[model samples]
Target: MKTNYLALLSLISILPLYAQQVKFEDFFTDQTMRIDYHHIGDAKSELVTIDQIYGYGIWAGSLLHLIDNFNNGAYYYKIYDEATGALIFSKGFDSYFKEYQTSDAAINGIKKAYHESAIIPYPKNKIRFALEKRGKQNELNEIFNVLIDPADLYIIKEEAKDKDVTVIKALYNGDPHTKLDVVILGDGYTSSEKAKFEKDLKRFTDLFVSSEPYKSNKNDINIYGVFKPSEESGTDEPGAGIYKNTVLNTTFYSLGSERYLLTEDNKTMRNLAAFVPYDAIYIMVNSPRYGGGGIYNFYCTFVSDNQFSDYIFLHEFGHSFAGLADEYYTSDVAYNEFYPAGLEPVEPNITRLLDKNNLKWKNLIAPGIEIPTQWEKKDYDANDYIWLKERTAMNKNIANLKRNKAPKEQIDAAQIEYNNKDKAHSDAVDKYLKSSKYWDMVGAFEGAGYSAEGLYRPMLDCLMFSKGTKPLCKVCADHAAKIIKHYTE
Candidate 1:
């Protein structure tokens, strides 16, 4: 028998492509499935239990990219076909519970339960769902596993809540499965403020597509706005003793950080977001407060009327969409130690720089550039410390004024004073950074990921690192492009 070597080579070349082409119809239907669970735990221990399974809506995720190649987030959920035991779908996501576990309350052993959900394509048959948490060294360890029967009568199949919610199609490129679909939801916008929501949505969508990577790939993206009115017109501000009857219950002062805006009402948020096909969720709060928050693959929130609203929207979306880590270390944060001492973070933007030769962004580094690149850290930190102190003091003063029922004019005056000082400080910092010899270089810069000494960022000034609307660093931008390709290609 004669064996044709050319045919053998051709077969070998196409085998991997065939394996990568996982047919959607073979394993999944066109519907979507959401598995709601209660995440209960503290700093030391955690547990997950099923709350309810929901079936509705069309799957907006890509059929070609069934597996998450990017190893991000604190937790990953995987689905396996029960009959063949084949891995079918998987995604990495961070939850509010994960952040809470790092808080002072969790460190003191005050356990809490958070409602979380994992959305996936509806399975064709029974499947095994496994939830894994990242260990200290960043290795995934399975913490919970359950076999789910899609045909079970217990699975909720009723009409989705908020089905009548108004949806604004801000941008429509093409099919959602072929484009990166982003759903924007509004909180604290009353029925009378529907026009305001529409205007805000248009402004944000335009700004988003105008940015670098998104601008270059605007034809491969879709933006939708899902608006369900709230009774009130502002979010809760616990630091100022102000509360409102918002739909999503978004609040400031989350996890002890005055500017950290987020919501614990995950169920309500998910329900409202279900009105549109979404690869990402953005909740725009109707407030003028300069506060916002983002968690990887979970959701991002920003107040709609802040002066830095545009920057916050882009920065938070970077975290929620591409899992970029915060690169500033001078500001105060609620977490005790976000990135462990010796461990490298899963985020693409920041690293511990454990090995100079094996640096994560080594390929992007220019020739003759030094690893752990040095800048004016001493001088920068000195100025930054002074600014941080003043900012904290100003925040406290404003909060007190609000609590004491001070005159609106007085509060506005204080805010205006702080805003002017803040602008001056920001300008000075930007100028100081621009004067660096390595200003345009892509080498590891010290002081990132909320640590002044150990962790490092790829560049000096990035949207992740500063307050202004600076563009993403080369490494960060490349990662964003890669993620965009994952959804659209």
Candidate 2:
């Protein structure tokens, strides 16, 4: 009876390999629609495409990852006319670019070694392919079928265990800015109080959207909360519940000293991204203290600490939203070397202003504020300038500020003490940066406690880069506007 049931189910199931006829016109209901696939690769590399996973077309913007597994390439599908199997429309779904990731690291390493003479070691690849519909009138490739690993493709489920009621309520904003789909996930503490959790999460998001910049275009943003239960303190201190398994004593002393687990990084993201059509992600963990992180064009994760979660969420969102770099140089951190001095940072905010010609925020700077403005202790807390330097001068893990550029005699002693605590320092820095290990992972400076000085932020002090209340700076606010524009009809 079991075997008979299996056979019956197989007969009723949709075949993964079957090709459905389609017409080019019917697939794209919006005549003015456009799908932009960024980051393609060389043609010499393998390219793969799979068909019809979630009624959407798929393509490989980059081919490096597919070549590694040539036996199976990425999959894609087409929606076309059934009778003639005529070509209609197709697209690439969920493209992965691991090889591109490896090459990026290699290039960065070369830059560090070469200094001023450094160059972009590897050129970005450009991979483009034209897909034909299964039963097109042209019928250029009727017999051929694109092959892919069925498991690699993600099928959108019909229902989710969790949904953001806040997003649904604000779905009717009038301005209709190109809204972003945000999926926010919480840590273990949230499950401790589910009802309040949902209400608080929704309330915060509402407050978030209601705030300036986003307020006028509220309908343009979709926010979802992924609240889960956890057993960790949600502060920025070392070893806070997320780093329990490291071989080293990776504790964040700022928050209450609690054991943290490192494994939750990617898993938390997967759980949240699983529920929405996010072009980018914003993660809000449940914690009262503050801590957060973000990467440009990547994701921003923050804690919902009552003390400063609101501002922190927006500040970190700055990095994720506009590639803004931290402007604050005072704080405790464990990194030995971050900026190379010679190379210009990719972020829009802080820069050496090397080629004032190509500065990302050149026009946004206050008229006379000098680039790398004079290092005046009086201006340390001022918003008109940005700062960057090591977190401490004590060489001990104590929290205090001192100019890193003092006389060499003093530097020598600090360096010596720093060397003595090399293991601990390295452990702390490693735990902070490079914490998340994934191909597209954009956080390496997370956990390191430093940020730019400013007041207008989403929260007081968040993990994004630093804390404080300030709406998205003009640079970030512009980026947000562009993203919103992209999705607007």
Candidate 3:
């Protein structure tokens, strides 16, 4: 006890040095530097070039924890003081560009560009910005580097919006730095629909903070909304050939996956998001299309009026906030071989079980739980694979009918048959999943991260595993807690 007290005193003495007076404020202002760039790539090659730099509004992230400890996202970037050669701000992130490169068109050497942006604290001196991306085997390779001068005349001095937009304080605590700052933006809502955006944003955020880790850590969060109205409502539907005059040209059928909704309008989206100091961005498109997208440390999207909006929001937030992966493997995603085999995924929840003794969430396993956890996986997968085949077949047919401009009657008929078949499949999956056997175990369960063969999840049933009413799995929930601490602690 005496020795323990002495160690505590030693830690207390060194704490002041770690929190030195010449800390974050000495090198950075409270404002944000929004660096916009063009990410050009094909499956064979990829690179980044600076497009624009702006002095955005206040910086809302943690001043003390300048370095991100959570290893997430397909890409990672860092900011270093050129004068002192000190790492200042760093983040792991993903983008639509990275996702696009995995498409079949990209493998055919169809090169393209995606507008991307990152927000950091406004530096007082020259800084070196570097970005590294995770390659095929999860190896980090430096892809882009730039020298930034805060006083450079080329750095544009602009606010978040060109035209006026209402900034609603949906949920605000005292200061942003101590809280996880989230800014919600709406696409495809008209000026008159601003009220609806606010209401919907409020509804989802309330639902968001009320979920597992967020529910227990509510006061540690701040929610803001940027209400940008479009001339017309509803986003684009390329499969159905419907386009609208929305600022952020959000679209469904991204990468030919009908439900994988995302936007290539990164500049416009980031522009509106910077209206408020935000740590995370959520874009709610005004459509009932049952679609959304989420990238780690980037942003998450959801359809505003979908019947499954609540569930979708939670699932996507798990990706965007806690960097959790989709444990469900049965869905047909555009990502072909998304998580490469043999390499352990960095997501907190899912694992390849390369080292059964050192599973990612090994500490969270309940006592006596089997390592390669036993569940009704053989029975579950047998039924799940069948359901996936039917679902994919139905979706492919619908997409084809839409692309060919089939008559409304034919389309309706196709959808009716698909719906009835879907109901039957859903019931079978539920029964297969409802067995009480090993449901509460924390051992690794096979089939996760879009793979049925090698990948495994930490639990049998979870929000990450399914759209069922279960909370996030133990591993996922613990990650959420760690993320909240990253911002608030």
Which candidate's lDDT is highest? Answer: 1
lDDT of 3 by residue, 131-187 (tens): 988877787676887889999999998775556588988888868889999988889
TM-score of 1: 0.95
Residue range 359-456, candidate 2, lDDT tens digits: 55555544544443332224324322222123232322232212333565665565455445533443443343233222111112111223333211
Worst ten-residue run, lDDT, model 3? 13-22
Instruction: Please provide TM-scores, in order, for all candidate models, with all chains considered together.
Output: 0.95, 0.48, 0.90
RMSDs, each prediction? 5.5, 16.7, 6.3
Query: Candidates' lDDT values, in order?
Result: 0.90, 0.38, 0.82
Candidate 2 root-mean-square deviation in Å? 16.7
Query: Model 1, 47-123: lDDT tens per residue?
Result: 89999999988888898888786999999998867765556788999989999999999999999999999999999
The global Cα lDDT (0 to 1) of model 3 is 0.82
Candidate achieving higher TM-score, 1 or 3: 1
User: How many steric clashes between backbone atoms does each model show?
Assistant: 0, 71, 0
